[model samples]
Target chain A: MLFDYVYAVDMAHTAEHGARKAGTRKRADAERNIAAIITAAADSLARDPDASMTDIAKAAGLGRVTLYAHFPSREDLLRSVLAQTIAESTGIIEAVSPDEGQAAEAFARMIRSCWPLLSRFGSLHAAAQRALPAGEVRRRHDQPMAYVERIIARGRAEGAFRTDLPVEWLVTTVYTLLHAAADEAAAGRLATDAAGEILEKTLLAALKPE
Target chain B: MLFDYVYAVDMAHTAEHGARKAGTRKRADAERNIAAIITAAADSLARDPDASMTDIAKAAGLGRVTLYAHFPSREDLLRSVLAQTIAESTGIIEAVSPDEGQAAEAFARMIRSCWPLLSRFGSLHAAAQRALPAGEVRRRHDQPMAYVERIIARGRAEGAFRTDLPVEWLVTTVYTLLHAAADEAAAGRLATDAAGEILEKTLLAALKPE
Candidate 1:
C-alpha cells in the first residue's frame, strides 16, 4: 500500500516535470529505493543471518519487484550490503592512527576505535560467509585486515610483539578474539561496557614478547 | 538394496531364534543400527554441518524410514552426535592430570590432549548451535568446560595465570583461541602438524601472569 501510494505520486510528478526532468526524477527515486533496501537488509541480516528477501522488502517499505529490480539476486544484495558496511567501518578505522607511537599502543588505539564494528557486523560477516565463496569473503576482509596486519608487522619488527608465532597466525588470532568478544557481549555473558577494555588488554597480553 | 538384504536376513534370524530369543536378537539389531546412524551422522555433519537426513541415511546404509525411526528430528540426531563426541573427549580429558605439576604445564597437557576434539568436532558444534537453544547447547558443554574452569581457577590461585582479567573471560578466550586454531588448520593457513604446539604456546602466553 505504501509503495502503491509512492508510485502514484511518482506518476503525477513525471507528468508535471516533463520528459527530461521526469527521467532524472525517476533515477533519483530508484536510487532512494536502492539505499532503503540496502539499509533494511543490513539491519535485517544483522538481526537474523537467514532473514528472507520478502521480509527485507517489507522492512524497506518497497515491493518485492522493486527490491529484485535493484538487487537482481541475493548474492548481489549481500555483496552491496557488505561493501556498504565495510565502507562505514573503513571510515571509523581511518580516524585511528595505526602508525602513531608504539606499535602496541597503536594496536590498542585501533582496537578501541574499531571494536564496535566487529560487534555490530559480526552477524553480517557470518551471513556473507554462508552465501559467498570462501575466497570472496576473505577478499572483502582484505582491506580491513591489512590495517591490523601493518600494526602487527610493526610490532614484530620492533620486538614489541612475540616473534615465536607467525605474523599471519597472530593476525588471525586477533580477529578471532575480537569476534569472540562480540559474541560474548551479544550473549550477555560479558559486560558490553567492558568488552573493549577486556579485548585490548587480552590482545596486548597475547601479542607481547615472551 | 543393502538394507533390503539385511532386512531379509534379520527376518530369517527372527524365525531361527524363536519368539523369545528373537525379541532379544531384534533389540540387539536395533542397537547396532542406532550406532551406525550415529557414527555416520557424526562424520557427515563434521564434513558438512548442513547434511540432510536423507544424506545421512544414505551414508549409514539405511533407509530414511529407519533413520527417522531412530531420530525423529534433526535436533534429536544432532544432540545424540554432540553427546557422543563429548563422551569420547571426556575420556581423553580424564587421562590428563589437571592437578599435577605447574598450572601452566597442566594446561598445556589438557590442551594437547583435547585439542583434537575441538578440531574434529568443530562443524558439529556449529550444527548443534543452529538446531538447539543457546542454553541447551551450553549445557551440553558443561562437563568439558568445567575441567578447563578448574584448571584456570587453580592457575589464578597459584599466580601462574594472570589475575587482571576475569576468570570467565579468560576461559572464554582460551576456547575462542582453540576454535580459531582449528579453523586456521582447516583452512590450510595453519599447519595441522604444528597446531597443537602453536596453540599451547599462544594460550600459555595469553594466560601467564603479567
Candidate 2:
C-alpha cells in the first residue's frame, strides 16, 4: 500500500520497440544506442545523479546530439534506465510460477531471483524515486510486486506462512528485508552470497506459521 | 553493516553549541536562524529535493542573503539538515537502554522510536546521499547503529535470537524493515498505527530462536 503511494508510475514500464529487420544495420544501430544509453545512464547516475547528458553520452561512446535524439532530457534518460530495470526485474518474476509450488519454496525462489536485480539496480531505483514522483515509481514497481503478493497468498493457503499480519504488511516486511540485504551487499558491508543466505533464512523464519 | 559503509558521519552526532553570556538577543537570533534554516530546508527538500536556497529562505521567512550566509550552497543546506536530523534521531536512540531489557522488547521500542523519524527524514536522507558521498552519511549513522549492535549481541547471548547469521546481518535487517515500513507509511500505503504493529510482530518473529 505504501508502494501504491511512493512508486505510482504508470503501469506500463516497457519500451515498445518494433522487431528489427534482419538485414538492416540501421535497426542494429537503433538497438545498440538504446541499450548503450540505458546501461551508461544507470552507471553514471549510480555515481552522480546530477551527471549531465553529455557525461552520459561520453560514457556510452555516443555523440551528444545522438544521445539527445534518443533521450530528450536527463530526466528522460534516467527514466528509461529505471523503466528498463523494472521491466527486467518483473521479467524475473514472470519466469517463476508462484502458484505451482509449496509457498515457502516459491517464496525462496522469488527472493533469490529478485535480490540481485534489486542490488544491481539499487542506485537506479533510488534515482527513480528522486527523478519521478512517488506515484510513478509505485506503479512501475507494481508488476513485480504482484507476483510477490501471489506467492504470499499461495503460502497462506498452504498454511506455511503466518496470517496474523495482513498479507500486505507481510509483503512489505519481506521486501524491506531483501532491500536492506541488497543495500548491505552493494555497499560491500556484507558479501553478496552471505546477504542472500541470511535473507532467505530470516525471511522464511519470519513468514512461517506460529 | 551497510551503515558502516554509507552512514558514517563521525560518532559524535550531537551538536556542541557554544555557551553564550546572557542578555544578548543576538545569540538567540543566530541560533533561531540556524534552526529555522535547517527546518525549512528539510520541508522544502522533502517536497522537491531540487528546491533552491531561495525557496528555503522564503519558507523560513528569511531573506536569501541570510539563508546563503547560513548555508552557502544547496548541498551545504541539505547536508546540514541531514546531519541535524541524524543527530536528533541518534539522541532519541541514545536515550533508550537497549541492553537493559529483553532484546525483543528493546527492539520493538527502538522501532517505535525510529520509524517515524525515518519516515519524516526519508527524503532528506535520500537527498543527502545524492548531495554527498555515501561515506559521509554512513559515518553519521554509525553512532546509532552501535546501539543496535549491542541489542543483537545481548539477544544472542540470551539465546533468544539466532547466531548462525552474523549479528551485523541481523542489525541491518531490522533497520531495513524499519526503513521500508517508514517508506510505506510516508507514502500512505499502510496506516502508521498498522505499520507499527505489523513491524513489531514481524521483527520479533524474525528474531525469535528457530
Candidate 3:
C-alpha cells in the first residue's frame, strides 16, 4: 500500500509537469503564428490592400482556423500589423545614433533608413486608414515622430538647423515631405533611392540658416 | 361661335404659358438647392468628417427629402463637396500671377493664396479619403498641383528656384509643405498666418540656389 501511494504521487507529478510543458509549447506556437501572420499580412496587404483573410492565411502558410484563432477579424489583424510596423519603425529610429555625427548627416541617415519602410507599406497605409479611426491612425503614425522630434531639437539647439520656424512646424514639415516622397516612389514616378536623395537635399537646404 | 372659339384658344395659350413659367421656376429652384447643398456640405464636412446627410440638409435649410433628391447618398454628397472644393481651389490658383513678379515673389504669392484652401478643407480631405477610391482621391488632389507645377518650372527656368532638383519634386515639396502647414493650423498648434509665414520662409530658403 505504501509503494502504491508513492507511485500514485509520482504519476500525478509527472502529469502536472507534462501539462505545463504542453502549455508552454502552445504559447510559443501562438507567438510564432502571430508574428508570421503579421509579417505575411503586411506583405500581402502592402501588395494589395484588398487582400482577403484567406489570402493572408495562405501567405502565412497557416490554416484558416489558426489564423482566425489568432486574429478574430480583419481589423484586429490590421491593428496588430500597424502596431508591428510602428514597433519596427521605432526600432529603426532607435538604432540610429542621432548624436554621433553632424545633425544633417544624422537626419539624412534617418531619412534613408526610414523611406524604404514607407515604400514597402504604402498600400497597407491606405488599408489602415480605411479600417482604423483617423485619430487612432494619427496616433500610431505619430509614434515614430518622437525620434524625429528629438533629432530636430538637437539640430536646432546646435545651430545645425534653422531657428526661424518653430521646431514643431519643422518636424511636421519633415514628416509631410517624407510621406510625399513615399507617395511619389510608390507611384513609380521616382525610385526609392532618388526620392530619399531628393528629400535629404531639399530638407537639408530648408534646414540651413537663411 | 367665332368669339367663343377665340376665347378658348386664348385660355389654352395662357395655361401653356403659365406651365412654362412654372417649369422655369422649378429648374431655377433646383439649381439653387444644389448650390446651397454643396456649399453647406463643404462647410459642415470641413468641420466634421462624420457630418450626416441630415445634418447637412439642416445646415442648408432644406428638407431631408430634397437633400436625398439631389444626393442619393452620403457618398454622393461628399463627391459633390469634393468637386466644388476642387473647382474653388483651381479658381484661387488661377488668380495667382505666377509670372508677373520675380519667380520667388510669385512663388510666395502662390503659397500664401493656396494655404487657406488647404486649411479650410483639412477635415474634408479625411472624409474624401474614406469615401472615395485611393486612385480617385489622388487624382482629385492632384488637380490643383498643375498651377504649382507651372510656377516651379518658371522658377527653375528663370534660375530663381534650384536647378539641382527635378521640377516635379520641387512642386510636390511645395504641395506637401502647404498641406503640413494647414494640418498644423487645423490642429491649433500654429496660427494660420504664422504657418503661412513659416512656409514661405522655409520653402524660399530651400528653393534658393545651393
Candidate 2 residues B1-40, lDDT tens each? 8887554544333222222334356778878999998998
- Pick the lDDT winner: 1
Q: Which CAPRI level is candidate 3?
A: medium
- Per residue, candidate 2 scores C-alpha lDDT tens digits across A1-210 of 878755554333222222234436677888899899889988776655456788889999999999988888877877788778878888887787766778799889878877777776545555565576544765777777888888888888888899888888787776557656655665678777666667888998888887
**Which model, 2 or 3, shows the larger TM-score?**
3
Instruction: Give the per-residue lDDT digits (tens) of candidate 3, residues A36-72.
Output: 9999999987877667899999999999999999899
What do the candidate models score in CA lDDT, each in turn?
0.82, 0.74, 0.82
TM-score of 2: 0.79
lDDT tens digits by residue: candidate 1, B1-210: 999999999998888779868789889989999999999998887767678999899999999999999899988999899899888977787788776777888899999988777777646665665566544665777787788888999999898999988888888888778766866765568887788888998888888888
Per DockQ, the best of the predicted structures is 3
In candidate 1, position A121 carries an lDDT of: 65
Task: Give the TM-score of each candidate.
Answer: 0.81, 0.79, 0.88
lDDT of 3 by residue, B1-210 (tens): 999999999999999999999999999999999999998998887777677888899999999999999999988888888888888888887798665777788878877887788788767777777677655765776767877777777888888889988877887787667756765676677887677778899889878888
Which model is ahead, 2 or 3, in terms of lDDT?
A: 3
Candidates in descending TM-score order: 3, 1, 2
Better of 1 and 2 by TM-score: 1
How many backbone clashes does every candidate have?
0, 23, 0
Residue A39 CA displacement from its true place in model 3, Å: 1.5
Clashes of 2: 23
